[model samples]
Target chain A: MVWLLVLIPLLLAVAAVLIPSGRLRPWLVPFGGLIQVVLVVFAISSENVSGFQGWLLLDPLGKLVLLFISVLFFICSLYVPGYLSLRAERPTRLFCACLLSMLGMMTLMTLSHHLGLMWVAMEATTLASAPLLLFNSSTRSLEATWKYLLIGSVGIALALLGSFFLAYASLYEGLESTLQFDDLIKLAPHLSKPWLHAAFVLLLVGYGTKMGLAPMHTWKPDAYGEAPGLVGALLAGGVTSCAFLAILRFYSLCVASGEAAFAREIFIFSGILSMVVAAVFMIRQRDFKRMLAYSSVEHMGILVLGIGVGGLATYGALLHLLTNGLTKGVLFLSAGNIHRAFGSKLTDDVRGAIRRVPMSGALFLAGFLAITGSPPFGPFISEFTILNGAIGSGKFVVAALFLLLLAIVFVGMGSTVLRVTQGTPSTPATATDFRESPRFVIPILLFLGMSLLLGLYIPPQLESLLKNAALFVENGV
Target chain B: MYQLIDPILVAVLLLNFAALGASQLRTVIHAIALQGVLLGVLVVVAHNEFTIWAVLMACAAITLKGIFIPRLLFHAIREVSIRREVEPIIGFIASLLLGGLGTALAVLFSNTLPIAQEHVGSLIVPAALSTTLTGFLILTTRVKAITQVVGYLVLENGIFIFGMLLVEAMPFLVEIGVLLDLFVAIFVMGIIINRISREFSTVSTRNLSSLKE
Candidate 1:
């Protein structure tokens, strides 16, 4: 089943290249996505406990991450066909192949237990996603692609250094040097404190770059802004989550070594800093896509903060991962529709999305509400849990500040979203442009429905998965 | 022979100095290529191994670093028709002095690390890190995309040197993967640089700064 999760996408990527018809290629996306999701279901149901040593693994955390990636990819895949169809001049074949390849690399990243293997997969994700960012091939897209490549490459390089430090930490402990997660965990207690400390910091900064956590988040806005809507959705909702999981894996090692407090401090500092950065940027954000990018940085902050707060907050953080992923999917896809509708992402230019395309506008508005942590939304529940955990942990000041930041972000994002969704259509609506095909609308609706359902009820199985994932983080391997 | 290699490390350091000092684009690329060749030779000497695979990898590194990259860059420079890196955001002497300070700081920081290995002292990691920092500094301070790519290559060389300290533990496959990725990355970046030069009439990142807030 684990093999199937990776295999289906790999196969689809090949088929996308082998099959020459551009029209036939777009279908490959949703088809591959759905098949991967089905395989994920099978893997989850079978409860496969075996891990392919020195390479892939299906631990509890991996399972949860795999599920998230699958679900997000499934949603984004539904949107891709319509997106590619609309951009009729561009070749869809490379786009489909790259997207599926990205999915495969991310799947591999989630399942990877060896640090070296994980690094390779993460690097592969960066390589695969660069072309996706360059889908439009404009000067702006080129700049974004360059920034993404350079920053991601640097980050991965630092991660490799950190992995070396981790291996060195084992040597310091008089244990056989290894980069396997299980082996590292087994040797955790004997590891040198200083090397472990350095390793954790390096890993956080490196992975944090990908997670878009504050100071290291310079590339997110540009890349997300330049990439197509579906591409943005996959990156924000899928790639970042996989990166977060990678951080959690290392955090688990720190916890086992009883050095978690040190790691938590770093997470808290970076997370809060990210929140402040996002809040400041969100205020004056004119471009809707860029605004979504900042929102992603903010949520990443919240996710890290949740983990930093610890205990039940870790559960909240894990849940926030799911919530943030789903909300971002809804927001980016719908925002894409709005961008397509107005032919601009500038909030000043895009007015009355509701009046323009009623379904997309409503979904956009709802996504805004959902993302801002309004009641009866997935993010709301998750944010509240985080606050509860913070307060329970006696971090009252942190909780207060967290709430304040959330409020500011809410106002900032809400004004932008509301401005786009509620105003009268400034442009005279052409009959041909106002109507988005069902292909695009269905994915937005699907993601919005999932998020709304999550708000209403937490399924027992998913609840268990989240709980187990949290435990895995708290207990290590 | 090991003691003789110390001056080569100094030569590597001087190459960075030369990079900082050189105003002409051609000189900078030449200095970087020299630094690459020096590092490649250093790798062979330091390892004291003549294994075919390791030697081939070393030669490939030298070729990519000293020859292929510089050649591609010269072509880019010709195509862009830019003569010098004008208005480098920092003056040459000051940047060189800062590079020195950065190198000094790297040594200071490396001393604080609790490295138990006695075979190699703190100098290698610190030198590599300082060079990496200087490369980053060049990348940010310089406006020209070609110079930035040169900076990136220098940065990768720094990382490669640092990786040498861990070569025993780091698998060959991972090393190969890193090199391949780096090659492709530069190739793609070179293509982007060409496109940027054509569209914007300049490869300065400032010209591409239209998408900001």
Candidate 2:
């Protein structure tokens, strides 16, 4: 069953590369996404299938990220068919192949129980996304691809070093060296303290770079700004979640080692720094897409800050990962529609999105409100929970700062989103031969609806999943 | 017993300085390629006995890190036809000085970390730290994209040094040289380095600043 998760996508990716029809190729994305989603649903709901031992297993954290990637990909897959059709001038053979391959690796990443295997899968994810970033073939996209690849690889390489350090930490303590998470956790108490601390620092810096954490988030703006919206949605929502999952694995190891406090300090520091960095850069941002890139940095900060705060905050952080992933899909996909309509991602050139592509534009606006913790949106619920967790744990200063950063980001993001959505439908935008097609708009609507539904009520099953995942991290077995 | 490992580790350290100090791109690549080959030798030398895993690792390190990666880099430079000189953001000599200072600090820092009794006096920890720091220095200070790749290679090589200490745990790391080879190909976008050159007409990352705040 675990092998099926990786095999289906790999086979479909091969099929995508082999298929010649430009018209028929992109359907492979949704095909692979649907298959994986079915597998995940069955895997989670049935609970009868035994997972592959050691190399692959879906724990609560893995299950949560797997669900996020599958849903996000399925939504983006639906968007891709429409997206590729509009740009029918170019071939999408490589794009489809790489996208499918990325799904395969992301699935492998989620299911990988071995640290070395996870590192390989994560590196593969970085490789798979490079072509997607460069899909436009413009020089600017080339620059974006260059930065994204170089910076991302460096981070992964650092992560590789960290993984080696972690393995060595166990060996140095006179234990048999194994990269399996189960063995590491079982032996965590006997691991060398200094090496464990060192490993945590390097892993945080390494994976945090990929997660777009501030001070290490130099690649986010360029990559996110230039990629097509569907690609950005996957990169932002899907790839970053995998990195967050990687961090959670290490953090759980820290918990097993009884160094939870040490790990939390680093998380809290980096989290606040990311939010502060995002807030500073976000004000008066000219490029709307680039502004969204900063917004991603801000949310990543919130996710880590929640984890760092612990107790209820850990649960809040876990829930926010899903909410943030869904909301970002709404924002990026809708924003993509607007970008397509105007053929511009700059705020000066594009406006009146609401009047132009009413469905995507309204979703984008609602997405902004929801992302900023506005009531009735899912992010509001998650962010409020994070707030309760922070203050509940007597982190008054962190709580206050978290709210202040959220307000600043809201004001900053609101201005850009409103600037893009408020004015009369512009001449060039309407002239781009783009329209509010149901195919393009439905996915955004589904994502937005999900977020709204989550805010109104938390589903009991998902609540259990979030609780289990949080417990897995805070109190590793 | 430690006689063979000490000289090899020293040679690796010398190559680090050579990479840091080289002005020409060809020389820098040569230094890095040599470092890659030395790292392969270091893998075998660091191990107490020759086994299939050690041999496989040495071969992988030589093939991927020592040969294949450098070949791809050379192809990138040749295809791009950029100037052979490495244009440093900070002067090469100053960077070399900084590299020395980092090496010194690394030795100092390694002493602070507790080590197993068997490996207490070995240079593996300090040398790895220094090489990684030097790699980072090259990446930040160099202006060209290819040099950045070189910097990354050095960084990986440094990390490779640590794996020598935990061979039992990191068996796949012996095969990691192949993964390292893939890093250059994928990061350089297989053949898109040529396209990047044609688009921008230069391989300097300085020009990539057009999209910035």
Best by TM-score: 2
Tell me, by DockQ, which candidate is best.
2
lDDT of 2 at A177: 69
lDDT at A50, model 2? 38
Error of 1 at B69 (Å): 2.3
Tens digits of per-residue lDDT for model 2, B1-213: 345766777888899999988888989898888888988887777777777877777887888778887887788888888889999999878998999999999999889888888888889899999999999999899999888888988888888887777764567754553586687766565534656677877888887788899
In order of appearance, the predictions have TM-scores of 0.96, 0.98
How much is A35 displaced in model 2, in angstroms? 1.5
lDDT of 2 by residue, A22-110 (tens): 87898989988998899888887756433656678888888888988898898889988998988777658888889999999999999
lDDT of 1 by residue, A1-477 (tens): 456677779889999989978888989998999888888878877855455554677888888889999999988888777777778798677788899999999999998888888888888888888888888989899889878877777787777767767877776555786778888888888898887888888888888888788888999999999999899999999899989999999999999898989989888888899999999999968898999999999999999999999999999999999998999999999998888888888978888999888889999999999999997989999999999999999999999999999999989988888889987988778734746768879989989888988899999999999999999999985
TM-score of 1: 0.96
Q: In order, what DockQ does each candidate have?
A: 0.44, 0.68
Which whole-number lDDT from 0 to 100 does residue A391 have in model 2? 93
lDDT of each: 0.83, 0.86
Query: Which window of 10 residues has the lowest lDDT sum in candidate 1 chain B?
Result: B172-181
Show how many residue pairs clash in every candidate, following the order shown: 0, 0
